[model samples]
Target: MISHCVFIRFRPEISRARRDALFAEIDALRHTLIGIVAVYTGVNVSPEIGMDKGFAEGFIVDFDNAGSRDAYLMDPGHQKTGARLVAAAVGGGNGILVYDLDTGHCLVRQAR
Candidate 1:
């Protein structure tokens, strides 16, 4: 299994309604795309001050494997959705951070 995580710092001009609508579109992709195990989206709610670093929203996408994750990256629907996200993000693409983890067994040592 693979977990794809994305965090976003949205531009100040983007409204809450717009953000919700964008997430809705992303959530809809789960049904249309193959190999997607699940999709989770939410706002940051940490009580610790200065931890979020302005990244107010995020999402997690679970895929069956690396191939599935690769396919999702190439999907047209994802491309469109990603474009919208980039546009609304602060400093364009700089405002988004993505991390992917392979949850399956590993033989190699984990990177530092």
Candidate 2:
């Protein structure tokens, strides 16, 4: 599985409703796209100060594999959604960060 994480710094002028709508559009992709296992959206909730570095909201998409992820990237609907996100963000492209992790390396160990 591939975990696609995107951190976003929304512009102050962007309304909460817009943010919600954007995330909604993102989540809606799962229905039309193939190989999307799950989609999770959230705001930074950690108590540690400054840890998020002003990136308060974001979403994670779990894809069955890298191919699925790449396909989504090229999807026209996603391109439009990404353009909307970039426009609403603080510094256009700079306001977003994307990271992908392979689940194969993730090891879960039970407590001793």
Candidate 3:
């Protein structure tokens, strides 16, 4: 599995409603796309304070493989949403962070 992690620091001017709308748009992609294992989005709810810095909101998209993940990245619908996210981000683009990892066996439950 491929984990696509995206963290966002939205500008203060961006309303919660707008944020929710954006998240909803992303969630809707599963209906049109393939190989999306899962999608999760929410605000930071960590016990440790200040650890999140300014990135209060984020989303995770689990893909079946790199091919599916790449296809999603090149899709026009995703590009549109990405543009909106970048615009609403604190520093336009600097406020967003992305990381993709190949979970491989790490995601498996080993018998201890």
The number of the candidate with the highest TM-score is 2
How close is every model to the real structure, measured as TM-score?
0.90, 0.95, 0.93
Q: Where's the lowest-lDDT run of ten residues in candidate 3?
A: 101-110
Where does the lowest 10-residue lDDT sum fall in candidate 2?
101-110
Regions of candidate 3 where Cα sits further than 4 Å from its true position: 105-112
Candidate 1, residues 1-112, lDDT tens digits: the string is 9999999999999999999988898899999988999999999989987798998898999999999999999999999999999999999899999999898865678799
Clash pairs, candidate 3, are none
- What is the clash count of model 1? 0
Encode model 2's per-residue lDDT on 1-112: one tens digit a residue.
9999999999999999999999999999999999999999989999998999999999999999999999999999889999999999999999999999999678979899
Better of 1 and 3 by lDDT: 3
- Candidate 1 at residue 102, lDDT? 90
Candidate 1 segments exceeding 4 Å error? 105-112
Provide the lDDT at 54 for model 1: 90
Candidate 3 vs. true structure, TM-score: 0.93
